[model samples]
Target chain A: MSLLAVGTLAYDDVYTPYGEVKMIEAGSCTYIAMAATYFVQPVQVVSVIGGDYNDDFLADLQRRGSDLEGVEVIPEGKSFYWAGRYHDDMMGRDTLDTQLNVLADFDPKVPESYRKAPYVMLGNLTPAVQSRVLDQLTERPKLVALDTMNFWMDHALEDLMAVLKRIDVLIINDEEARQLSGELSLLKAAAKIVEMGPKILIIKKGEHGALLFEGENLFSAPALLLPKVVDPTGAGDTFAGGLIGYLAATDDLSFANLKRAVIYGSAMASFVVEDFGTRRMQTLDQEQIDRRVQRFGELMTVSL
Target chain B: MSLLAVGTLAYDDVYTPYGEVKMIEAGSCTYIAMAATYFVQPVQVVSVIGGDYNDDFLADLQRRGSDLEGVEVIPEGKSFYWAGRYHDDMMGRDTLDTQLNVLADFDPKVPESYRKAPYVMLGNLTPAVQSRVLDQLTERPKLVALDTMNFWMDHALEDLMAVLKRIDVLIINDEEARQLSGELSLLKAAAKIVEMGPKILIIKKGEHGALLFEGENLFSAPALLLPKVVDPTGAGDTFAGGLIGYLAATDDLSFANLKRAVIYGSAMASFVVEDFGTRRMQTLDQEQIDRRVQRFGELMTVSL
Candidate 1:
């Protein structure tokens, strides 16, 4: 089974309480492909980048087993760039700047060979763009998981709903869930959102962890405890990547399997936040991940 | 294996999005005794109330197997009364009124039998009053657990710190933990607080869940999923009661035992939030609690 990861590849200027970084390699696709590569090989990535994007970063991702055949690079255009400052709590942030650049008129093209990838992860993007990626799929993948933010619900709800109906899973934070469903209670929000489209809804609660809902069955995943979060830059996208990647590698979509995937996702996320951008994700090995996963199990284990 | 509970027994008026209730039987001691009685018999309760306090409610608590010999009746005064409105999220609230009345000049007198109790729970109240209860105890209990709020931390740091040094366990919400330790990260806060006195720390995160930290060991407990939280007034005290009660019943203080106690606490807290004041807590039976505890286990169980 193969996983198709489609989203941005951009440059980010981030400021956190620990420190600040300039022109760091970032974006949803960057994180998704990196994390997914740990469980599945040749993460087929489809996105648009600009000439300003660093070649070394591309080489780094390629070495980690990402297929970049579908990435459209504009010769003269600048890459998408964003600057943000995290609040002291790290849960909230203020976006200082966002430059669309090459992404303004972007069109995503799915590589013909990647069209049939069984696990497709549509990272945070314009809902219309997410829907277009689904159109290019040769067949309906085993799981079409989309990650979106509150912006889509506010400005492009109709388009978002269209994409929601087509996907098998929706992964959004608690705030996004409330905005989309107009319900404050997460259980109520999950119920209404599942009815709207996807059968499975995951409400991510940053440090608090995530809730998975499939009809009457619900699973809660705890976030790995950390004394400090150096930076929270790509945690969510990394989580989505690790999740879909595990599902693709194991080729299992059972609810039980999804729970394991969430733990793997959370484990990957815990690493990403330990450092700015994806530094920690790049350096961690399978053994460290296995131990982290075990720690997660231990964190919630109790003999009663 | 006896447990002593000391705090205020009062009347509360609460408003939530669901509805509003006025002059209901509410207080830290009331919730604690009710939840603790399920696990430990003759929960020795020591608190001060007034002539205006409902006698039937006290009789109801007594019926639940609480030993109320230490409760003081101030016939000339009125019971402590609180009025508050919960925010839409049910996490934040605004205090509309607080009349300490009888609690203003309270001096707790631990009963002779209760003075020798091995397990003790100090609910939220003036640090001076809580210290008075400890002073009257015949000997140091096996485990002295204290619960306090930010108000005490802000107004009586000297007295609060003095009480902190005497307790084996410190159970407080995330915000109060941060406030007391002056650290934004909970892990850091737990580390700082534990050094201050308590050997074990439990940081409760209302709907998010609870965390237990003992030295280098840590445990995370997931909150039960509810469609709606009717009211969250006494959830914390209920959690403290359930936790201490379980410890007293089993007479175990191992980290593993503490973890199970946390799960029991979380289960009890979950029920408290289902209805306003103690309405839900008063009606729940042991069978329901057992099922809820099993649910807590299932909520965090992941077969990785």
Candidate 2:
């Protein structure tokens, strides 16, 4: 089964208490596509970049099994560039700059070859962009998982809800779930959010872990405890990518499989936060991933 | 194996978003003894209560299998009284009043029979008072676990450290662990805290769950997702009580047993927050306790 991912591709500068980085290869799709490739081959990317985008980076993604047919390059404009500084706690950050040069008038163009992809991951993007990717798809993918942030909830709620109705799963943070559902309790928020759209809700809590809710059934996945969080920039997108990628690989949509997918997602995010940007994410091996996944089981299991 | 608990016994006035309650049975030892009796026999309590303490409450505790021979009556003073208003979150509270009448000058006197209790639980109290109880014991217990809070860390670091060195296990919340260890990351905090004293460290994160760390070994427990948190007043103390109680009942001090104890502790705490103070904690039967403990197993288990 093919997996398609649509989101941003950019150059990011992250400043954190652990350290700082400049001009790292980043963006929602960059992390998503990379993480997705770990479980599924040929992660089809539909994103926009500019002439400033590194050709070597594109080549590297392709070499690692990404289909970049729909990744448009605006030769005259600079690529999307973002700068952020993480607070004392890496849980949050302040966006210093978001220069959406090539992405300003961005139009998601799905290649015909990728239009029939059976799995689609709508990474954090404007609701309109996320919905547009679906509109271009030849058929409704077997599973459509969308990731969004609170900015859209604060600004484009109507648009966000429109996209929600068309997706099967929604992967957002706990805070966003509360804001969108107008409920303080995560259980209530999950219930309210499911009624609005997406039957499956994955509420990510930075270090605490993630919660998976489908109807009355609920599963809590603990985050892999890292010795230190070097950078948290793309941890969430990487989590979503690994989740859908594992689902796409296994082709199992049962609640049990979804639970396994979440564990895999959590394991992948553990690697993402280990190093700045996608440095560690891009270098992961199956053995390393397997060990982390195993650790999650051991960390959570108590024979009682 | 007998389990002993020593700490405050108070009348608490709690106000929350759901509603408010007048002076009810509360305090560290109250919740501890109540939660402890469900897993172990003869939960021995050593504390000081004023004449205002209800005789029926004492009889009720005794009826529920608590040995309150060490609970002294200070007829000249009022019982310890605490008034707090829980914010909407229910995870924390603002202590509006803490009129420590008898407790201000509390000098715990452990009964002769309890001096041989193999399992000892030192609930949140002045480190000086907790040490006094241990110093009065004729024989050393097989396992000694102490639960403390941020207040002690702030006002009596030396005293807190003094007690830490004498305990076999330390059960405290995430915030207190960070404050005590002077480390942010829990992994690092666990390592630093263990070096200072106890070999086993249990870090409790209210709604998130708890972490059991012993040397290089670490286990994560998920909190039972509640429909709504009615009150979180005695949840932590209840958790500690359940942990030591389970440990004492099993009579195994292995890390594996400690891990199971943490889960049982988590299950016991799930009931504590269901209602204000110890209202829910006091009424739990063995069957109800078993079900919640089983639910925690199911909740945390993911067959990978």
- For each candidate, give the TM-score of chain B: 0.98, 0.98
Model 2 lDDT per residue over A1-304, tens place: 8899999999999999989999999999999998999999989999999888899989999998999999998898888899999999676789999998998899999999998899999999999999999999888799999999999999999999999999999999988998999888898888899998899999999899999999877898998777798999999999999999999999999999999999999999999999999999778899999989999998987888
**Chain A (alone) TM-scores for all candidate structures:** 0.99, 0.98
- DockQ scores for all predicted structures: 0.77, 0.75
Flag clash pairs in model 2.
none
Regions of candidate 1 where Cα sits further than 4 Å from its true position:
none
CA error at residue B50 for candidate 2, angstroms: 0.6
**Where does candidate 2 stray beyond 4 Å?**
none
Candidate 1 docking quality: incorrect, acceptable, medium or high: medium
Model 2, B238-286: lDDT tens digits are 9998999999999998889999999888888899888888889767888
Quote each prediction's TM-score. Answer: 0.99, 0.98
C-alpha lDDT (0 to 100) for residue B57 of candidate 2:
88
